[model samples]
Target chain A: SQTIHQWPATLVQPVGSPLSLECTVEGTSNPNLYWYRQAAGRGLQLLFYSVGIGQISSEVPQNLSASRPQDRQFILSSKKLLLSDSGFYLCAWNPSGRKTQYFGPGTRLLVL
Target chain B: AQSVSQHNHHVILSEAASLELGCNYSYGGTVNLFWYVQYPGQHLQLLLKYFSGDPLVKGIKGFEAEFIKSKFSFNLRKPSVQWSDTAEYFCAVSYGSTLGRLYFGRGTQLTVWP
Candidate 1:
């Protein structure tokens, strides 16, 4: 069974703060990892995706970046957060050859 | 570029009512379709997927979706709805060699009243 884990389940940060959200997968190796931001009525927006370690493809230009430091570990970071950066962050993964993706619990960030 | 379109943004239905959520994709090439459900306060879960073979795919919780290649539509259907079925449903399309790059439609929020 494969599972994805994301943390700080919920966070509240002031504007102009640094942000880092981590995602890790279990029971899978060399999986395709993705970062998405979900907003109410806006659906899930693709942020970044990685095929392997040190390889990240960003979908949209934003105040954030992603890194695949380890095979199953992905991190989303930002040097300075903006008020518009607050949303539900989701991490997902699928096997290398599959198109079906599984999502994590998600991190709700509130930038005040 | 591939894109998905969900016709309904919000739907209100009573218990025992029928459900038909429309989902359409713009890519005519080889594509994989999926429907995901997100219950209140829960993560997204796969409701069903269409890779090939049967055009009609059955999923858990008595939900099913039909893939119409000519129409480019994969609409979800349920015979009878329950109050517990209140959740947001998302339609996604994936094609080419983009790996996990799935184009998602703005989800349809289904609210069932008992």
Candidate 2:
């Protein structure tokens, strides 16, 4: 069975600080990876998606950015964090040519 | 703009009560619909999906949704509710033209009293 993992289940960062959230998938290769932010009432917003290594697509313009260093490893980063950047971040993966997505546990980042 | 809409923001019901959540979309062309559940401090889990064929599709945990193309609505239904059913539900849609993007609604918070 395939499983997705995310690091720093919870995070507390100061404003203007750098941030890094990692996501890795097991039992799958060349999968489509996505980054989403779940706000209080806005539901989940797609931030970035990657179909392959070094190929990332941004769905919305924001303070965050995403990268696919390895085939199954995805990273979400920010040079300087903002108060509005605080939210629940989720990483999801789906096989190529498939629409169903499997999500990770998520990282709750609180920017103070 | 093309988007997914969940009419109810929050719903509170008693145990054994029926469950009905409305989800509507305003996109043209072939689209895929999905319902996902998120418990407290948990990630979203797929509840059900509709692609083609039967209009009514059953999902895990006794949850079912019917897709009505004419109405552009995909409503979720459950005959009985349990306290464990207290969670947030999200509706998402993906158009055929958009290959790797999914449009999600604002989510409905379901609170079931025991």
TM-score top scorer: 2
* Model 1 Cα lDDT, one tens digit per residue, A1-112: 8889999999999999999999999999999999999876687899999999999999999999999999999999999999999999999999998889999999999999
lDDT of 1 by residue, B1-114 (tens): 667899999999999999999999996978889999999999999999998999999999999999999999999999999999999999998886678688899999999999
- Candidate 2: where are CA atoms >4 Å away? none
Candidate 2 clash pair list:
none
Provide TM-scores for the models.
0.97, 0.98
Candidate 2 lDDT tens digits, B8-77: 9999999999999999999668989999999998878999999989999999999999999999999999
The clash count of every prediction, one per candidate, is: 0, 0
